[model samples]
Target: MTDPVLPDLWLDWCAVTGTPVDRRDEATLGRFVLQAAPSRKLLNTLRLAPLATAPAWPPALRGDATALSQLVHGGTSRINDPDVHWITRLRLRRLVFAAVLLAPANQGGLGLSRIQARGLTPGRLQSLRPVIGRTADEASCPACAVWSWLDVIGTNNDWSQDALRALGHHRDPAGGEVHRHERDDPSHGWLDWPDHPNLLPAIDQWGYLDRYGSLHPSSLSSLVHAIETLADARIAPARPASVEPVSAPPRITAEEEAAILARADELNARVARILKEYS
Candidate 1:
């Protein structure tokens, strides 16, 4: 059965906010925004009312309903993307390395201090692709997606562009080339910079690498946004190019060719006359 309380609460929210009731379903309402701050606004409004608690939703809808409640009533957590153009390869590598270390143990992330002791080595990240992609898909969290992205593209411009295109995210045409140091080697891993600075800790419990740790907020926001966009993306296969047929045209009699040309000329003349009249 459809949960009546959610719709009623949504209606009440709409009435108070004067937002047009576009959708009454639970899922749409979960992501619904009104003037950009409806999540906070609706929650505050509901808090003032005498409602003892949030409505009890079914198993199918409970997840969405709970998420909506957390977003509006509890709080909304915003994770930004990392800026690639301005970011130095060293910092980018550090961020990705830290992410790998900070990934949950359940996801096969190396949360060990001994692994951290070995330092940010390219070898450490070589076998972590499975965990990264797995966590990203199953966690239903933006942080996981960020981890997956860091694993997939890291500091490689080609992979970055390809991944962005796959996710339907736009890369700036005039963003200019990314910084490349002479000794930088991406094949080793995102953390392979030997001479680069070590700014990140071996392990971050607060999920800094996923967020704005040493990186700029806008950059992190951009990376997260791109990964989130990747969720609904459907990459279609490239269409094959059309090839011209090699078969020769059918031979025609001289008289028939002449008649065809005459007919074409007559049609052209008729079109010209019509155009002249219209003009």
Candidate 2:
């Protein structure tokens, strides 16, 4: 089914991912970009979705027309040997948060209100400096700083693992993954300061954090773009999601799938040029 009416609050998945629409299946609804994921937690008041949030995964990956829900999960969702530089890490971390907002199912919210409640730049870093590590008593650590921001949005940073993986960064040198190992050492949860979990101590493992102070990336700007988009959705409420059904039934046979893709390629055949436009 297509969302005939644009959702009151939806994110442009293709725009954020810089990816263009290639599939034109009956299952889709939005005009150019599709609504892929659902986000109702923390920021439930706002309607936010990624550009590709509603479309199916690239058909190349689902030749058999496998279920997308089964595909999106069960994979590690993490990239291997990622850089540990603070700037790279921070951008990746922010994207991880954004990824959760784009999750396809059983999604949760970040409880993110402070940025909207308070201006994005005001008192944020200072309010954050106090408890950015494993606990309030520890020294300021960038990794923990991420957690503190999450703590503002949700219960703890543990919620970030799925987000991190979905966003494609599993090699967290700062080691936010420590929460996964907590069952083995219950006291790991009790540690109140200084030490957060990591494959190696972030101090010794990541040299970039100490080398750089406040350098930012285009990602931060892109994030601001997303925030502005969501903030506007809250104020204006956009259009209601269309519930009308597509002419095609829920299931399509293999021959039917082939015909659909062929029609799509014939209709939107620019390929490289189109990807460049969207990319």
Candidate 3:
């Protein structure tokens, strides 16, 4: 999954999938990748780039377990339980945001949000299950805990009333409940985001969910960096050094070349036969 291996991985994927390497169609290629069925290997290749960088996949595919773990660490940790954690304010918001954003309804997420979310879910919480790395509160059921926290946050944010109410509560019939740390403070306004369904660009632009949203790249980088730094802490950064230059695509082995040639010849022959039948 390192940078140096990406070229090989891409070449192998294309060969296995019978796709050609076409740099001119990177946008198309990127979309092709997103629409394809999920593969762990495919997932790793996409992570070679920063989530906010050019050629980025949509946020649905990007919220892998590692990213989810980092986003919801406090909730997963017994020692860093939201009740005692110093950064609980920010951590809890990020957890709720990630839950709503990443949990794909069509997937096993039970329609946690109206968005086309993917990745984290109650069943999948087993992946982020806390180890005894810390000692404060006993590790609880992450799935139930997540819903409880969502109910608390949504209630605090008043998501049950007015505009946000139309979107529905984060906790519904499908969601289970657990005891959550009590919070009497005012809402921090994490969802004060733009109306865009895909908040990835908005997050990339405004640098975090806030009242102000702007597209001017320079003004947003610092803010984006700060939030992304926290969220992407566990994510392996892209390695620019190992990336092959644009002109030099990965070299296929002689065996691979022959296989591709043979496949090409087979297709050509099939076409000729069909043409002859028409003729």
Candidate 4:
């Protein structure tokens, strides 16, 4: 799914506020200011002038007294309506904070950190799927969590280990195969990665079970297709050997490997930048 319209909304706000743009440090803060600008009067009263000027705001905004104070005193302003200022400031602060937390980070420049990355792994991914059955509203609930996990994988660029671990597998002590059978009932079912072709169907199934008490037929079909595709890709044999047999396997040039790594690194960096901005 594409990101929510909040970033565009925030951009509109920035245009109205005449806020300065800093490409380097203030990218996130610029977004916050634009997003929060609709409530400019309240923001002014709260003295959240710094938010208007901050290069990057925290991904989550807390509503404690300290936050309140920072919002009100951060910027300079001539408005002095104390009574109205305090009430509007408090109300606007809560509203803005809630929007920030609930909004999808990828769509904007918001993202989870390394610590947050740990919670968004595959094991946790399934737990969120059950919520989809509750209602169409439930789809987004699981999606948000799943997207967070994807973001972690995409940003880290460590598909072999981190990605596998996020998918609920760990190396066994005796051998290097993925560990299984250690978990309880529902989680135990997810041990075989190849069994399920893609993660989307499982996500849909989770939603259906959580919301409707049964899986939809179409959803099941989708899951089957995904699994078939995965299996086919995995078991497919490599291309046939050349007509003439060679003494040894062809060696990859250092330049070629370096180019591939560079490309991968660039892609990861781009993803990371987007995540940071939206976060």
Candidate 5:
């Protein structure tokens, strides 16, 4: 059955349906997340001063297809298609990143190398993944883990991989986070970050924003369609060609072959005779 409105958190929706959050489209959560989104008000209310300058949700987010379409030319396309998914993924990613950038120094950015955002193995990533109430706190240090947004959405494909990895993060084999200069950073070296320093509180602000974006109907539906597309392509990229069996020619005996060769010789001789006679 189709769901009318998406739950406040992706995990909440997953829990109700008993489906993995990564495979959200399989849950049948229904049409679009037409309800509450850009849960920015929750983050905005943070009394911190550094976040006072971060950009707020874009106005285009609230309107209907027509208004949203104007934000990016393809925003009005069918929800199941890649265009609309792109619209949801990109706009939402930007929205959250902008908010993080504006967050109070303690809550958001840390001198920790932004490079920690890259090369996260899916296993380690899952360990860091956040649920509704616990999203921001999944990582021990919110500042060090500020780049979680990249891992949440980036690992799937080339475009997303590049966009998120561009903001790179790295860790030592001991799970210690490392910060390297922009010019020297390499994609190869990193390890699972340890849970130590557990000093920072949960990044509730980011958690709220992530759930808003991922649980939205647009994001979930696009994921389902994308999975189906891949499956369809694998099953049959095009119609399969039909095969027909052929009967073996009657076996020819040695005598029959000799007779055929004799016949051919006879015809050739006759033709040659005729040619000579004509000449």
Candidate 6:
């Protein structure tokens, strides 16, 4: 099914007011905007011409009410996207490695004592450069370079289909390019890059980070925003009084409880020894 056209009223509200409409106002405003001339003009600009072409609402759509409510209220989490999780994991790994390298030899030795005492071996250090997507040879644009690193860390060592769709592309049935004025000259409009036919899926992957890196405040926030947008657009309209739900607690089975209890006992024993001197 074709994606739902982003409502012009919503877009205008976001642009002019710099805030999402409160739930109380959204439905009423949405209906009114559907019939307004300005809204029609905005829809035309977005090329959503045949308003009647929207797909019949899917039966499974109602099953996603919980997700839609989360999006409208802005209270979802990010672990849902594997790509974002992978990016965060890699970043954490890098941070851990840096910390180990900086730690003093007497404290929790990281096997880096020899390296700290006598400097890093050229070959060993060289191996790390490629892992971080850096070269000793040249300078690159910082933004592009970071995205290149993300490409290596993200899905299948390539771009993700979801990321591509977020940037306005379809896989099976193709879609048109969005063109915009590059300069104010009335004749100098530029189409978005990574054009189709020659488009590489890896290049398409960069679009996700580009569009969402800022929007995703934390990994959890990214998940929440993604779920909300998808749920709202693809599922049902949110209710006027619905507020975003709080995060549900993690589920723990009996075996997990035993593990926690064992860990607590071990910590208690250590604390008891430390407190004996005071007694």
* Structural similarity to truth (TM-score) of each candidate: 0.23, 0.23, 0.25, 0.19, 0.18, 0.20
List the candidate 2 regions with Cα displacement exceeding 4 Å. Answer: 1-79, 82-87, 98-106, 111-221, 224-279
**Tens digit of per-residue lDDT, candidate 2, span 80-178:** 223333323333334333322222221221112222211222133223222212222111123232442233222112334344233333332334545
Model 3 clashing residue pairs (backbone): 104-117, 104-118
Q: In candidate 4, which residue ranges exceed 4 Å CA deviation?
A: 1-250
- Which residue segments of model 5 deviate by more than 4 Å? 2-212, 236-279
Q: Which ten residues in a row have the lowest lDDT in candidate 3?
A: 126-135
On TM-score, the candidate that comes out on top is 3
| lDDT of model 5 at position 254 | 64
- Residue-level lDDT tens digits of model 6 in 192-211: 22111111111122233332
Evaluate residue 122 in candidate 4 and report its C-alpha lDDT on the 0 to 100 scale.
39
lDDT (10s digit) by residue, model 4, range 136-242: 22111223223322322232233233443333221112122321212222212323322222222112211110211222334333322322222222222222334
Q: Which candidate comes out best when scored by lDDT?
A: 3
| Candidate 4's TM-score | 0.19
* Model 1 misplaced regions, further than 4 Å: 1-99, 114-118, 133-279
1 or 4, greater by TM-score: 1
Candidate 1, residues 213-244, lDDT tens digits: the string is 23333333332232222211212111222563
Backbone clash numbers for all candidates listed: 11, 17, 2, 23, 11, 5
